[model samples]
Target: MKKTVFITGASSGFGKETVRLFHEKGWNVAATMRSPEKEGELAALDGVLVTRLDVTDEGSIAAAVKAAVGAFGGIDVLVNNAGYGALGALEAASDAEIRRQMEVNLFGLIAVTKAMLPHMRERRAGVIINVSSVGGRVTFPFTSLYHATKFAVEGLTESLQYELNPLGIRTKIIEPGGYRTEFAGRSMSAIGAGGIDAYRQPWDKMVEVLAGWPMSGNIREVADAIFEAATDGTEKLRYPVGQDAEQLLAGRVQMDDVAFKKMMVGQIGI
Candidate 1:
C-alpha cells in the first residue's frame, strides 16, 4: 500500500517541492493550498490530489483533510507549511498584523495538528512535520512578530513531542535558514510604521544584508529533510536545513544572550 502525505501550503516553495518529491517516490500526496484551482502542475500528477486549505480557517482545514482521507484512504504524514513571513519592526506592526501572524503561523498550525490527532491516534501511526524557521530559535533586528510566532511553534512542537510520541505520532520541526523561496519574495510582508523613522536605518541595513547574503540554500534540501523526517521513524524532533541554520543554531548554543545580541546587531549594522 502506498503511504499518503497531506501537505499544507502545497501551492509553492518547500511545500510544493515536497509534494512533487513525495509523489515521485510513489506516495499518495494531498497537495493543498488556499487556491488549489490556480495550481496546474501538481494537480496533473499521478497520485496527487490538490485541494483547498486555508490554515487560519477551521472549516477549510477539516474539509481538506476529509477530501485527502477520502481520496487516499488515510493520511500517514501531515506537513504544516502554510505560513508567510511578517517582517519589519514590531512597533510598526498593527494589532491585526500581529494577530494575523499568530493566526496563520502558530494558532493555525496547532489547530491543524489537533484536527489530525484523532485520526493518527486511532491508527497509532503518523508523522507531523512543521516548517518552522531558524528564526524560531534566534532573533534579528526586525521581524519581531514573525519571530514571535515561529518561537511559539518551536516551543509548542517541543512540548508536543513528549505527549504525541507515546501515541506513535511523530512531531518534527524543519528550521530552514536563508532559502530563496516565495518566503523571501511574494510570501514576505514588511510592516512599516508611518512615524517610526528611528527604525528605518536598522530595517534598511537588515534588508540589505539579507538581500545580498550568499546563503541561498535550495528549497529541495528542505523538502528532502521533510521526507526523511516523515519516513526516518526516529525520535529526532528538529531538523535544521542549510549552512546558515546549522551555524546560527550552533552559535545560539555556544554564545550567551548578550553576545548573541551583539553579534546580531553588528551583523545587521544596527
Candidate 2:
C-alpha cells in the first residue's frame, strides 16, 4: 500500500519542497497551508491533496486532519512545519506578539499532535517530524521569543519520544540553520523591528551578521532529513541540518554557558 504523509505549511519554503519530494517518491501527500486556494503547483501534482490548515486555529486543524484522513485513509507521517520566527527585542514585543508566537509555534504544534495521536496510537504506528530551528538549542541577540517557542518544541518532542515510543509512534525533530527560505521574508512574524534603545546596538549587530551569513544550504537538505526521519526507522530524536546548525550546536555542547554566550556575542559583533 502507498504510504501517506500529512504536511503543514505546504504553501512555501521547506513545506513546499517537502510536498514535491514526497509526491515524486510515490507517497500520497496532504499538502496543507492557510490558503490552499492560493497554491497552484502542489495542487496540480499527482496524488497530492492541497488543503487549508491554519495551525493556530483548532477548528482548522481538526478539519484538515479529517480531510487528510478521509482522502488518504490514514496519515503515515505528520510533519509539523507550520511556524515562523518572531525576531527582535523581547521588551519591544507587544503582548499580542508574545502570545501569537506561542500560539502558532508551540501551542499549535501541540494541538495538531494531539489531534493525530489518537489515530497513530490506534494503529500503533506513525512518524511525527517537527521543523524546529537550531535556535531551539542556542540563543542569539534578538531572538528571545523565537527561542522560547523553539526551545519548548525541543523539550516537547524529546518528552513525546519517551511516551510515544512504546505505543509505536516515532517522533523526530528537524533543526535547520539559516537557509534560503521565506524565513527572512514572509515567514518572519515581526519584520519591522527595534523600538527599544537599550537593545539597539546589539540588535543592529546581530542583524548585520545574520545578513552576511550564507544562504547556501539547499532547502532540500531539510526535506531530505525529514524524509529520512520518517523512513530511516531509527530511534534518533534530533537531526540538525546545515553547517551553521552543526557548528553552533556542537559548540553549544563543548563550551559552558558563559563561554557560549561570549562566542555568540563576539560572532554577532555585540
Candidate 3:
C-alpha cells in the first residue's frame, strides 16, 4: 500500500509544495488547513484529502486526523507546519501577541502530536516532522517569541526520541533559514515597542538589518527535505534547509557561545 503524509498549513508555502510533491510521488496526502474552503485544487488532486484543521482547536485536529485516516487508511507521516513568527522588540508584544505566538507555534504543535501519538503508537510506526527555523538554533534581536517557540520545538522533538524511537515512531525537525514565503507577509507580525522612544533607533536598525538578509524563493527545496525526512527511514533528527541555514548552523556548531554571539551580533548590526 502507498504511504500517506498529513501536513498542516497546507494552504501555501512549504506545506503546499510538500503536498504537491508527495502527490506527484504517488503517495497519499492529507492537506489540512484552517480554511480548506479557500483552497480549490488540492481536493481535486488524486489521493489527496483536503480538510479543515486548526492546530489550536482540539475538535478540528481530531476531525482532520479522522478524515485522513478514513480516506487513506492511516497516516504514515505527520508534518507540523502551521506556525507564524511574531517579530519586534520583546517589550512591544502584547498579552494577546505572546499568547498567540505560544499557542500556534508551541502549544498547537504539541497538541497535534498528542492526537497522533496513540494511532502511531498502536501501529508501532510513523514519522513526525516539525517545521522550525534557523532561529530555533540561533537567534536575532526583536524575535524573542518566535525563537522561544521554535527553540521549544527543537528541544521537544529531540526529547521525544527517547520514547518515540523505541516505539518505531521517528521524529524530525526542519530548520529553514531564509525563505521568501508568506512568512514575512502574512505569517508574521512586526509590532516593535510601539512608539517607545528608546526602541525607535533599535527597531529601525533591526528592520534594516532584516530587510537586507537573503531569503530564497526556492521553497521547493524545503519540501524536498521534508519528503526526504519522511522516506529516509533513518534515525536522523534534524534537517536544516537553505544555504543561509547551512552556513549559520555550521558556524554555530564550530564556534563557542561567546564567539557565536559576536558573529551573530555582527550580522544583525545592532
Candidate 4:
C-alpha cells in the first residue's frame, strides 16, 4: 500500500514541488489549494488528487481532509504551507491587516492541524511539517507582522512536537531562507505610502538589502527537507533549509543581541 500525504497550498511553490517529488516516489498525494481550477498541471500528475482548500475556512479544511482520506485511504503526513507575508512598519499596518495575517498564518494552520489530529492519533503514525521561515527565528525591518506570524508557528510546532512524540506521531518545522519561488511576487504585500517613511533610516536600509538579496535556494531544497523530515525516524526537531537559513541559525546561536544587531547592520550595510 502506498503511503498518503496531504499538503496545503499545493498549487504552487514548495507545496507544489513536494507534491511532485512525493508522487514520483510512489506516494499518494492529496494536493490542495484555494483554487483547485488553478492546479491544472498538478491535477494532471499521475498520483495526485487536487482539491479545493482554503486554510482560513474551517469548512473548506474539513471538506478537503474528507476528500483526501476518501481518495488515498488515509493521510500519513500533513504539510501546512498556505500562508502569505504582510510586510510593513508595525505602526503603518492597520489592525485588520494584523488580524488577517494572524488568521491565515497562525489560526489557519491550527485549524487544519486540529482537524487532522484525531485521524492521525487513531492511526498512531503520522508526520506534521510546518513550513516556517528564517523570520521565525530572526527579525527583519518591514516584515513585523509576517515575522510575528512565523514566530507563532515556530512556537506552535515546537510545543506540538513534545506533545505528539509520545503518541507515536512526529512534528517538524522547516525554517527556510529566501527561496526562488512565487513567494516574493504573489505572497508578499506592502502597506500604502509607507515605503521608507514608516521606518527609521537604518531600518529602511535593512529592508532595502533584504528586498534585493538574491534567492539562493530553489523549491527542491525545501521539498527535500520536508520529505526527509516526514520519512526519517530521527529525533531532529527543526531543520533549517538553505545557506542563509543555516547562517542565520548559526549567528543567532553564537552572537549576543547587541553584537548580532551590529553584525547585521554591518553585513547588510544598514
lDDT string for model 1 (1-270, tens) is 999999998898899999989988999999989998899999899999999989888999899889999998999999999899888878878889889989999999999998899999999999999999999999876788888899999999999988989999989999999887888787888784435989777777888888887767578899999999999989899999999899999999999999999998887687
Task: Summarize candidate 4's per-residue lDDT along 96-186 as a digit string, tens digits.
Answer: 9889999999999999999999999999989999999999999866678899899999999989988898988899999989888877678
Higher-TM-score candidate among 2 and 4?
A: 2
Where does candidate 1 have its weakest 10-residue lDDT segment? 186-195
Q: How high is the lDDT of residue 185 in model 1?
A: 80
Error of 3 at 19 (Å): 0.4
Report the C-alpha displacement of residue 11, candidate 4, in angstroms: 1.2
Show pairs that collide, candidate 4.
none
TM-score of each: 0.97, 0.97, 0.97, 0.95
Residue pairs clashing, model 1: none
Displacement of the residue 164 alpha carbon in candidate 2, Å: 0.8
Q: Specify the poorest-scoring 10-residue window by lDDT in model 2.
A: 189-198
**Error at 93, model 4, angstroms:** 0.3
RMSD of 2: 1.2
* Candidate 1 global TM-score: 0.97
